[model samples]
Target: MMIRFSKMQGAGNDFVVIDAIGQAIDVEQVDWRQVADRHFGVGADQVLVVQRPQDPGNDFRYRIFNADGAEVEQCGNGARCFVRFVHEQGLSAKRKIAVETLAGLIEPELLDDGMVMVNMGRPDFHTRDLGFVDWQQARARGQADIDDGIERIQLASPAPEYLPSLELDLMSMGNPHAVLFLDAPPNDDLVEHLGPFICTHPIFPKQVNVGFAYLASPNQLQLRVFERGAGETLACGTGACAAAVLALARNKAREGLQVQARGGNLWVEWAGGQSPVMMTGPAHTVFEGLIVLPTR
Candidate 1:
């Protein structure tokens, strides 16, 4: 079967967006791995499936599939692209729309500059809130550490990296992320090397969105991320949020700042809002095409 799909992006994080609202397609049959496979399928950081909203009050139901074919809770960049896709397709005429994700309802606003700003809702900081714990400490003591630090609170678990522990900042901007700041942002090669290590590190329970960041300004940042389910991508929306929150906590950045992702630059500034932060960026529609998936 030829599944109609659209390619879209926000910053540089690209996606294979499927609008499954009007028709019924067996999602179970889709070999999503091949779709996200860079060598064989439609290469992308994440695959987004857009469905009609389950709640009449919402605009759409947003489903996310990582390159590994695992369905995740949320994706900020993907959500922006998803909204743009629907709007350009005439799915909704409303500028402000709500999308239901595994993480919950996320409000997206269509801006005049052709960018979409998302009210990623309130951020979740506790580690256990999203099912994660300290893995390195567990390995250290052969007993494991139960509490791993995320954004604000630490959840109990086993394992913390290093001698006694490693500080992991966990934040949920609709999606779960584990962030660790370095003296300076690691180089690309280092990011490629240690990124997978920390990503799969025994300390992270559900794995994590690994980030390497260096503060550029109180309102500016430079970063590279290895996303969970997806590998290194040009950008990550939730990843940006995680970094922004961490920057704020460390006083590295003020309430607002710009986070430079591998994909492009995202304007994020948060002082205090219904949502603590606001991510503003452009969502673009690339050329549409039919991609044949490999059976093997």
Candidate 2:
């Protein structure tokens, strides 16, 4: 079977977006790992499958698969690319549309400025929401603290001599993330070293994305994220939202903060409380192509 796909990117987080709505796609038949492999296939951080919404209230259904072929609940960067893909493919004409994801319904709109803005729903700070299970144990061991409904936990450092431990804020933006504030600028070495440890930490039963963030200013944040299944990419949209919301909740940064990722910049806005986080960023169509898939 042959499948048509678009190579798209949002803030440098690239994806191979397949329009399952336009063609017959037995998702199970495609080797997602091969599709996302850098050498063997159309390289991408993730594969996005666009299907007709199961719920009539939604315009479409967005499915995300990591490089490892694991289907995930949400992806912010991919969400932007998703909107652009549907329009470019003549699938939708509306500037704004409601899409159903495993996490929930998300609304993404194309702006006059050529950027995509997404309503990522309210952030969830409850440990259970992120599939984080070690909170109670950490609290009993005096390694965790809860204030204002946000939980902060201490994680032992990979190198105890240089840094005994690090504090991280755990939250879910439809996906799990651990945000670690850094005093200095984020370097590749630091992110590569500590990111994996936190991503696969035992505390998180389903694993988590790790974000190393530096507050450049009250409204400017520099970040690097090591994704759960894709390792570190050029950017992470949900990571930006997670980090920004955590900063806002802690009063470390104000709303409308600009998050600078390695790939590009994303703007995040939130009114706090139960308000949804709004993320604005660029999404581009790199190219389109057809690939053959094997029949079962």
How far residue 268's Cα lies from its native spot in candidate 1, in Å, is 1.5
Clashes of 1: 23
- lDDT, candidate 1, 50-91, per-residue tens: 888899988899988899989999899998888888888889
Candidate 1 regions with alpha-carbon error over 4 angstroms: 134-166, 272-274, 291-296
Q: Please estimate how well model 1 matches the true structure, expressed as its whole-model Cα lDDT.
A: 0.76
Candidate 2 TM-score to native: 0.96
List CA RMSD, all candidates. 4.2, 1.5
The 10 consecutive residues of candidate 2 with the worst lDDT sum are 128-137
Worst 10 residues of 1 by lDDT: 154-163
How close to the true structure is residue 157 of candidate 2, measured as C-alpha lDDT? Answer: 96
- Backbone Cα, N, C clashes tallied per candidate: 23, 0
- lDDT (CA) per prediction: 0.76, 0.90
